[model samples]
Target chain A: MTFLPPITAYTCVCAVGRGRDALRAALTGMVGGLTRFDDPVGVLDTFVGRVDGLDAVELPANLTDYDCRNNRLAELTLRQDGFEDRVRAVRDRYGAARIGVVLGTSTSGIASGEDAFLAWSGEGPLQSDFVFEHSQDLYSLSDFVRRRLALGGPSYTISAACASSTKTFIDGAQLIAAGLCDAVVVGGVDTLCETSLRGFNALQLLSPVPCRPNDADRQGISIGEAGGFALLERDEGGSGTALRMIGYGESSDAHHMSSPHPEGLGARLAMTEALEMSGLRGGQIDYVNMHGTGSHLNDRVEDRAIADVLGPAVKCSSTKGWMGHTLGAAGAVEAAIVLTALEAQIAPGNLNLKRPDPEARCRPLMETVPAELRHAMTNNFGFGGNNCCLVFSRDDAR
Target chain B: MRLRVAGISVIGSGMVDWGQAQRILRGAESWDADALTVPTPTILSANERRRVSKLVRLALGAAEAACDSAGLARGAMDCVFTSALGDGAVTQAVMSALRQPGRAVSPTHFHNSVHNAMAGYWSIGSQNHQASTSLAGGQGSFGAALLKAALSLSQSGRPVLLVAADHPFQPPLSGTRPTDGAFAVGAVLTPDVEGAAGPLLDIEGGVNGPASETDTKALHGLWQTCPAARAIPLLEALLNPKTVVLEAGTGYFLSATVSP
Candidate 1:
């Protein structure tokens, strides 16, 4: 069965910019957001795509219990492009009880929890106000959104590492198809945190420089934090020109916890399933957003999968060069990037590439080029061998 | 939409196995949360076993038990695992490690930190290629996962395995969670088929929260501590010879009726 849900409205806040315009400009200009990141844990010297002005991003007084850098960043994104207002509009369109909220976050409030722990070690006990409501758990992101939107419908959070937010779209579509909710507010948010930085560093995936996807000399990934939300609804009746989600496929490697399978078997399965569900063939896709993390195995395996599925002809690029890897938020932020690229009819080039990986199957775009952008696909694979692919197309193409 | 429960398992403080837990839920046996002990998943390679956390053990253990109980190959179905509170111990370890200058993070701990780590381990152990999802639905995690699994069961021709696991956060973090026993609940639900045994349940979606009507306080506390016990309402029906109604929050209810 075809799972089609049109993204009626969407917005995002990332290191590259705040909304579609900022992201699109960065994509078109090939500007990289990587800068020398001062390791919060004081472990290593590396570059990161950290979001600016997080300190200035104020939390509403009512949400003090949920006050944390991650939630603040989520709120910052929610306040973008009138995303909250759009959600309220959705709630209004379909009574509040008919709307569901789904969010993805790898590090919801762990950053705040870390601070609280540090104080505990220095002092005696945690302050009386320290509650886990919006603190360290994964549920806080969705809880925050649900309370903010005042929606009394189904709500949840997905945390499949990098694929966390991407899978939320699939979940939302299922919720809608199952007739549980008329409209689903799907969002992804992950903010910079000590655990993430130190952990990735320990895994030796953090690049010493701004990441260069598929670049022959590319080293590793530059992590970033971002938040984005999409309003997903069943297509009732329309001119068929609006951008909407056509298909999604979720799979697991079951191979390893952290590293992906060398053969890209899981990647192939996810991409194939997505294409099958979208009712489109490899030749039908105009562009592919590779989950290029600028790492050796990641790009190599993903490229092999892309080559086998979309073939060498389809245009492919990694937007991570522009905003870094946003972890749980990568899926949603990159999905938005694909939509913006589709809108402009331009396939953004893979930035910071001095030379392409010889093992790559898909030709990496190095310069922005106008094309007949129709059906675009994006891939996001996370830890635990979790993989997800989403297909979005312009309704006008119908 | 309804599901035929082929196999079910619950692990926590009280029972030695799912069978014992089922017996207790049925009121045939005494309840003891302290009796729960998570054993090493012998299904995985020793190397893989060494790298797993307690939370992984809880999830995969229950999956194995459920599949075994249903007389189905573990990989014969897709899987969905939901946890309201992901392993607090791991989070605390990572957080403490990050607070220092050297910041020496254990390679094992870092990889085991993802919410889907158990799903990945289960896939590796079962060698299943089917899709898997890990979710957190705040306080109503089990209900949300059941709804998601129902979606999968409806879309796919194969059965879907739904696992809900919750472990109290460690230490000061554990103070609030109050759930003394870490538990994982497993249920193998297939498309309701003809001649599928005597007891069957039709999960009717669209009911909000646990019914305000009535229930034993012990069961309520079980749910409070072990989100997996949210299935207690369902187990209450399966354990008893009588058909019962299970209410899911957010106005979605799962109505399970035993076959006459």
Candidate 2:
């Protein structure tokens, strides 16, 4: 039985110029940022890798009912840049019914909701802008994307905290493998909000300095916001570039609500399953994009697991240095990074690591490393002890 | 891939409140786990029992019943549990606490707020280390859960047990409630496993049809004020040989079938 061929990936990043050009620049080290901020939530920090010149414009009066800055930013990623035209071109070739859309986000428009609450405090309910539509509605993201893109087939929103968007690829692959859809547009997007900032502040996990992933003296995680999406298909002939989701593994630890299992049991299981499903072994992995949120427990557990499973030879890095942890959008953003690395042949260096933890067994990539790309994997773990690992490889390299 | 639903069961406040515990038996005239019990025996652990919200308990208890009915150990099955408002009790607690400054949200309450809290509890209780997933799709939650469970079974050889549950929200929160009682739907499905009596019907085709009058009655039979109501229409159709289609959502186009 023939399975869906692996999809090629087209990606862009902070260092890379926007679109393919920006992505190419990111591959060559064209970017660095303001890394200092005085805020406790890490939102106003100097190193936020925010996309320059992409401002949230006031949408038309008719679309005001969908009021939310998150959704408005979402439009720039989903519709601007002629992405719809590119999608239509793919549909013209693959057929419309064959395509599906699955998106991930932890707090869809929560920032907008936070704004509304502040407005309600100042202006009475009637005076407040139409903010309620965004705050409480569970379908805020899905409803907006589906309506805006006119995507009729099986559109849904996934919210599993930071790991949400990466899991969308898992769902997308299953649908295509099951012959549900021939193609899927999958990714995640999230904007910063006061709720998230305050929530992290309350947790006492925000780093005032730029985050250092594997450093022994690393502070807490630095927060970042971004929107990233990828159009995926079973066949290679589609929009952007083709990158197949070769393998994915999902497991729940049931161990802790907010903390990872001290043993990294779920993460290890996810990595093992992903490798197994990909029909590859630990020795075959050329690079791994660690979840490296810079949290003490997270980095320690992940580092030990990487050393134990894949060994000390495999190159690893936490790009969270370049971009603050994008939370829900991290998976897609990192996925973009992985594809960019494979295509450009240079792995992005882990940004702020001054001294690698001696206890960490896995080798942390400190500078742009050039290599013959074969296979790469990205891992994400969520708040509920939910873990997902995805493995992507160069179609021709293998 | 053609996957089979090998075994399934549902337990809910509706069945428990109906006072017909025997309906769950292999051969009972009627067993409704939704009924109210006479003695109201506690189903949760002593430490957390008092604070157990109806939905969490029903989800756990119902999945246990499902394990019992399927004759499979909890540790043996891959699981998927879902809810629209996971631990509505927790949401209420958090919202109320947030209203008061300096009131710390209980760590327990915060943990249970995840939509898949039931799955997390099941994983620990059942000791099922296999893949477990949690999904929430508002009114379309059941169908979404079913789709996810079937996909899991298909992709992997493991037998999957799905528990979908929900409870009526408390006052103020009640306005958001879709069902009035707590409910849970559980199914033990194995790849290519045939039912003893017949080939379990695998549903396909129009699942999102526009709602109509005929669809309303069919949907009403499945409708209850709880998340477990999802299993009612399904179990009703399965028990009755004459039953033809199980409408999964409001749209007329989507339905699943069980047939030879």
Q: What digit string (tens of lDDT, one per residue) describes model 1 on residues B1-260? A: 66678888877767657777666665677776556688689779999998887888988889998888888777768899998888777777876775566877877788888888888899989988788888887657887787778888877757888999887666767655465667788888888777554346565555544533214444556766666666676666665545444433334444556453
Name the top TM-score candidate.
1
lDDT of 2 at A376: 89
All candidates' chain B TM-scores are: 0.89, 0.78
lDDT per residue (tens digit) for residues A24-67 in model 1: 88888878787888754456777888889888887777877888
Backbone clashes in candidate 2 total: 49
In model 1 chain B, which range of ten residues has the least summed lDDT? B208-217
Per-candidate clashes come to: 16, 49
Evaluated with DockQ, which candidate comes out highest? Answer: 1
Write down the DockQ of candidate 2: 0.24
Give me the runs in candidate 2 sitting further than 4 Å from their true place: A1-64, A80-82, A112-137, A238-242, B11-13, B17-54, B86-89, B92-109, B170-181, B194-199, B205-208, B211-231, B241-253
Q: What TM-score does model 1 achieve against the real structure?
A: 0.95
Q: In candidate 2 chain A, what residue range of length 10 has the lowest lDDT sum?
A: A118-127
In terms of lDDT, model 2 sits at 0.64
Model 1: per-residue Cα lDDT at residue A30:
76
User: Worst 10-residue stretch by lDDT in candidate 1 chain A?
Assistant: A233-242
